[model samples]
Target: MELIDSAARAQQALEGELGGERMILNMGPSHPSTHGVLRIVLELDGEEIVNAWPDIGYLHRGDEKIAENMTYTQFIPYTDRLDYLAPLANNVAYAYAVEKLCGIDVPPRCKYIRVICTELARISSHLLGIGCFGMDVGAMTVFLYTFKEREKIYDLAECISGARFTTSYTRIGGLANDMPPEFLPMLRKFLNELPATIDEVDKLLTRNKIFVERCRGIGVISKEDAIDLGLTGPNLRGSGVEWDIRKAHPYGGYENFQFDVPVGTAGDCYDRYLCRMEEMRQSIRILQQAADQMPDGPWNAPEAKIVLPEKKAVLTKMEELIHHFINVTQGINAPPGEVYFSAENPKGELGFYIVSKGGGAPHRLKIRSPSFVNLQAIPVMAKGHLVSDMVAILASLDFVMGECDR
Candidate 1:
């Protein structure tokens, strides 16, 4: 049969079976159930969905266009706003791009620090994303429990970078600052305690009959479909694909880390949730290794012209004054080149493509936002699922509006 004929016959059969009683529902643009500003137009027959169309761009900020006008250093802060749940991942992505463009290699110590901060960011993102999903699904206690741990991670972030949500601590060559004395000890504590917390959360939701029934079979996307649609992170892993950017590309010395990329056999909300939970444990393991094997050295890449001068040096030395003045006033001029850098961001493959025209500012900068691409799968996955499951699927996808619209 012709494709159009087959589709028409299927529609005819469906409509005849339902007696033309189909209802349309708008999921959100402002609905509290949606984690961010997203709208899904659903065509339903009673409780079962017939089709779903996702309407996006409700949180568009034009961040990529703004980056073209801003200098490389100035653009770093904007990256933080993308995946606010994992701001450090945004920092790493943008910094990785600039570093690649300028051919800058970070010191071993700086790399370890980067790993620690990025992993913490990953854990923080999963905490909020999964925790909120629990609340959306009527498990309010899970939300509170998740946030309790998330807050601890955020506190650790603040201790390290002086900010929680919008930490632009990563600079082009390396980081904006060095790790403090107390940061490691606190992180070690968190690392030690995290497994137990994860166990509690797992026991709370993973095995509950109600939670399983709601999640186990809904929103199933096959591995081929996931890859074809450019899905990454836990969503793809839930579909049984073992492709992780940290392992596949290994930027920022992720190659040194020994960890497992957990995959789920069934591509469903439950599988995605399980993937994230396992990911948090893996991130903690990475952090423990990083903290243990951390090297002692300057955190910033040792380039006086590109890197900012120390305040003490600027005060004490006249030559330092000249370098500082040139760096801040004129800004760092990257060579005429373009580079694309991708990292294993919390959301997925957060990547930045930077084009430098051998000037103080970038000629063009584009972000390959994971949330934006990950959200694309919604229309496909959400179609034909119940309206209530729409919320579950949305939470499972974990789309951050800032990154999507940016």
Candidate 2:
């Protein structure tokens, strides 16, 4: 009884010595680890996180409201700024959204071209994501390797779209122009070299002791939590959901290609990284399929009223001239209706809902950015983990503020 009383007194003394008030930490709208202008207010019990509040809106430019005022075609450039990492994919998603609203189907060739662009965008995006994930986890070699391949993708983007980063490549009805003659050859060469680079990166970080220890079993989100929290993209799949927007709702001719969605069993940071790595490989497969099955036809739809006529005809013919003038002065005349179309972007399901009141501009334009949805899961995932693990968690999420804040 004397020893038991002493033990109880010792326990109380230890608790009194060790415990204190919780701390409130600010992680930044400028911290490099945050990946962009994202700030998180973390409530901490020493180094362990008790709760997290993601404070977004630092990079907001009112993109949705801007879309309501501008023409659909005019807003294409703005889409580039949404997910700046995969501008081509953003352009494709927005263009498809407008096309769906207008009830127009672009030609088969256009669809295939779009698929090619979208997949390349996916590969490009995953490269940077994987590189940054490695960098955040202290694997610098992987970052260098992925960055080199990413540069090649940027070259391809510049070749195809005449803009490297914010590529406003897609149009309301089709592309700005057909693929340049040098594009396919360069793309083929890049594909040939890409696998080797991916393999190199895989060797560097896939089973690295430090990387694995830092990521595995850290920031784990259950499959149920992932779905309920509306986590999309790799973050969602990393939770073993297997809910890929491409496979579920094929867009931009994704149905024509065959690829696998990489789902994770652990739903941790390591699993998310692995999912991205595998996704890059699947994107390569889709790219190869698209290249082999390249179609031949008009790149743009034949709709004269909404689609601008060819330059040759516009100069010579009055009807074509008038259509061109209206297409330039105003935007395409979309029917009075509402439509929501989303594409499986590299980040996740990028959805655009348009409420059109029979005009060139939309009455309401709403963007469902995956970054925004995925960022919400941070609070749940970061709970009970050390503050240092926050870096890996944020990296695994791989979200950009451009789209999230927009």
Candidate 3:
């Protein structure tokens, strides 16, 4: 009886506030278009949305709490699950954070390789994002075109990390292994072919009257609102803000690469979509420069204490065997300090904050996932828009629930 009375009171409060005129609609916790178990409770007046409240946490795995129980190196694979679309980027970001906490500097060659990996991840992520966005808005051909290109990138990732989807390739000091001999040749071939494909995609949707009408001026966000909401990545750039972590922070030799940061004028769904398309071209440019300036040197840092010994050395030498055993069993000893590191991920800024008490594992770990942050803008963008326009807005933000709900 008490439970029923509480439910009655809650319903009365909800309906009374809107004067019983607004209808409550639950968009999804499992709908295909919500993108990943995201539920949005929308207050609606006919076709117009009065308010939208996003409900998350369906996919929560307590990743931050889990980090406290695992070694720093042991946590890399978990980052892969955060932004499953760009696992390599997440790997780099988390590794860099641990490296920063430990005061480990990876070699120059390692930095360049990391840059290449991150850019490739960015390109792959954006291709899928754009393709899916197009499909959401009823353009089927773009999905086919983008997936063909994405598969080639997956091949490259597999060559580097031996796994395509969850490439836990980065270590605190460097990568698990250096790029294969054949990797560069395949990368060059893909670079040469990708530009023409991008142009084809551009021509297909950029000027289409139907596409433009559906996207442009829908779900617009101004620069001020975007900044206040802490939006980042292409979503922030799409709002005509010229802020990119690569340009502003310059991590992992990104400063050495020459590329342009694309900005939009209208700050709408169309502009966000355009920002992602142009970003792919910029990623290609960065990749070309990284490939040309590729240096040959040690892949890992010279710190033997932090980096694992080679497997061959561990098998042949007693000293190497002990080093490997100790490092594997105990993990790298991080200094007692706190550090925050963020990378320009496909969605936005993927940041990791670590606090260490001079141990192999973190005292506390926090992940500032971009999808979680960027999803905050949905309510701001969705209000005052028709129900049909909500899909375009959600796609423009390019969020993954894996990251958002983490």
Best by TM-score: 2
Model 2 regions lying over 4 Å from their true place: 1-17
Candidate 1 colliding pairs, count: 0
> Candidate 3 at 182: error in angstroms?
0.3
Query: What lDDT score goes with residue 121 in model 3?
Result: 91
Cα lDDT for residue 218, model 1? 88
What lDDT tens digits, residue by residue, belong to model 2 across residues 280-321?
A: 999999999988898998999988877767788888999999
Worst 10 residues of 2 by lDDT: 1-10
- Per-residue lDDT for 253-302 in model 1, tens only? 89999999999998999999999999998988899899999999888888
- Judging by lDDT against the true structure, name the best candidate: 2
TM-score of each: 0.94, 0.95, 0.94
Error of 3 at 269 (Å): 0.6
Write the residue-wise lDDT of candidate 3 on 156-199 in tens digits.
99999999999999988889998999999999999999999999
In candidate 3, which residue ranges exceed 4 Å CA deviation?
1-20
In every candidate, how many clashes are there? 0, 0, 0
- Of the two candidates 2 and 3, the one with more favorable TM-score, higher being better, is 2
**Candidate 1 Cα outliers beyond 4 Å, as residue runs:** 1-18
Model 3, residue 152: what's the lDDT? 96
